[model samples]
Target: MRILILTHRVPFPQNGGYPIVVGNTIKGLVSMGHEVSLISINVKKHSGRQHERDDLLNKISYTEYGIDTHISVLEVFSNLFTRNPYNINKYYDAGFEKLVLQNIKDNHYDVVQLEGLFVGPYVAAIRKNTTAKLIYRAHNIEHQVWHRLAHQKNDPFKKWYLNLLARRVKKYELELLNQFDGIAVFTGEDKNAMESFGAEIPLCVVPIGVDMGKYQPEPDKTECPSLFFLGSLDWLPNREGIEWFIENFHKEIVDGDLKVKFYVAGNSIPEDFDEYDVPDKVFIQGEVDDALEFVNSKSIMIVPLLSGGGMRVKIVEGMAMKKCIISTTIGAEGINFAHGDNIIIANNAGEFYDALKRCIADEWYCREIGENARKLVEQEHDVNKVTRDLVAFYQSVI
Candidate 1:
């Protein structure tokens, strides 16, 4: 099958969550004897420089277009009156639209996969220009993330703005449902949410996948108890989560005289992090070369997300590396994680502290949970099996 993937960012490098999903899916499709072509916006934040590759397609093969993704004070004021969410309009690229139309008409693709809701606006052009089956690959219920964020925020103005944006996104998400031929959601919970939003289209839960062969666990584990939170710092949820942890949990744990060290790694570390009275125990390493290597080096992984949707690709990677993980329930959502078995679920600051303390106290139990995590990923989240099922899903829709 010939598949064309539409993404909002360059899918190469595969460092972040969005790219990891897109890149891994492309790799899986190609390995499974399918022709995969991608069309992506060259958003500067997501772009990785030139590199050598053996794949048939790379950055050069895709029709990449640049767009102004930044929002000024004036743009924010103007967005209040616009019907479309500011998030969606920021990615509007005329050249991208034209290239998508041309690509659809020129290439005979069996399926055109839209990677996220932001790219849903191009469905009309795709439908008109091609007879391919349009698949909406939903990363998450987008509005749910904003709604959760709104609730978590304390500032009145920010809360109001987030609530307004959430409403707009929800309306747009519902309207996008009937526009696609089929929907591929990242989680069963997201699938159920779509159905509740009046989605009647054929849909399947196609979770994010990892190449098991590439993510081998470390033979010699770290003996010391250390926690690390790894994710894209540019993402609001991750930034907020880490900040909350440092303020509410990290300080207390360290102040109480615990011998635990915390590490942070991700791209685009905000400048304001310097202002915060971050503890001496916390090391903020901005963007490492190898994400898997960083994860393997750590004894325990942490996902302290308070507001976000979709499975955390990092959590899946951590599981693949057989790292004992402590995450909030919201953070573990969509991954179907077991509380005491595969992962440790901590809802509040105290719970988070307690979970980490337990991990530190019982080294043998931590190792047991890490092994359980690896077993779960092997059974459910393997990329080869996932793509094979996805191909069958494509056939069903066709």
Candidate 2:
């Protein structure tokens, strides 16, 4: 099978989030004797990192177009006069559109997969140019993230603006539903959500899988009673979750009877994050060199997300490394995890604090949960198995 993957960013380095899923998927498909080609839009922030995976890049046909996706106040104001969603319209580039058309004309592809909702703007052009089976690989329902953030905001003006964006996004999302030949979502929950929104096209749940060979658990190196939060700190939901945890539960945990340390590690830590008055036990280690090593060294992984959609990749990575995880219901969404069994569910500050205390007090219980987490990922999220399932789905759609 010859596959073409179009994405909004260079899915290499696999440092965090969707890139890990996308990069792994391409490699998995290539290893299974399928020809893969990639067309990616690279922004200034996430560009120039593809060199880290030159070996992977050499295995497949890859092309990238640079674009400025930074938000501008003037552009936002101008968008109000038009019916097009400001968020979706910004990703539409005439040059990129032409490039996509030329790419399709040069080669024949069995499937052209749009990696996320942001790339939906390219559907009409691809449909017009090629007879390939178009697949929309939805990372999440885009509008729901904004909708949740809008409801969380207390300020009147901010809330109104967010709500407006959410409304525009929802309309755009619904409009693109039937444009694709098939839809592949990361979770069953996402598939059901799309169905609720009147997506009657062929849809399948294909969760992101981790490469087990690279993420083996090291139980002996685990730092007992230590808690860590790792993700892209520049993202609103991540920054919001961390700040909420620090404001409500950090002090109590530090001052409590148990001696524990909290570590924060990720890329792009914001300047304002330093303003929080946290204890010495709270170490803000921004953008570590090796993510897997960092995860293996930690005892417990904390995901305090209050809002967001799709699956949390960090939680899955932590689980694969045999670390006990405590997350909110929203944080643990998409993954089939059981509270107090494979993972600990903590919706509020009280529940989070209690879970933290329990993990700190009982070493045996913490290790047991970590072991269960590892088993879950091995059984469900191995990369080879997931890629095979995804290929089968593509064959069925064709």
Clashing pairs in 1: none
Task: Give the winner by TM-score.
Answer: 2
Model 2, 85-202: lDDT tens digits are 8777778899999999999999999999999888888999899999999999998898998888888889999899888988999999999999999999988889999999999889
Clashes in each model (backbone N, CA, C under 3 Å)?
Answer: 0, 0
Per-residue lDDT over 1-398 for candidate 1, one digit per residue giving the tens place of the 0 to 100 score: 88899988876667899988888888888888888888888886555467455354652246677776889899899889888788986777777899889887888999999999888778887898999999999898899999999999999999999999999999888988989889998888898998988988899988888999988877475635877889887788998898888788655555675567778888888876655435677677878888888888888888889999988898999998889999998888888788999999998977877888889788788889999999999999999989988898999999
Judge candidate 1 against the unseen true structure and give its global Cα lDDT, from 0 to 1. Answer: 0.84
> Which whole-number lDDT from 0 to 100 does residue 242 have in model 2?
89
Best by lDDT: 2
lDDT of each: 0.84, 0.88
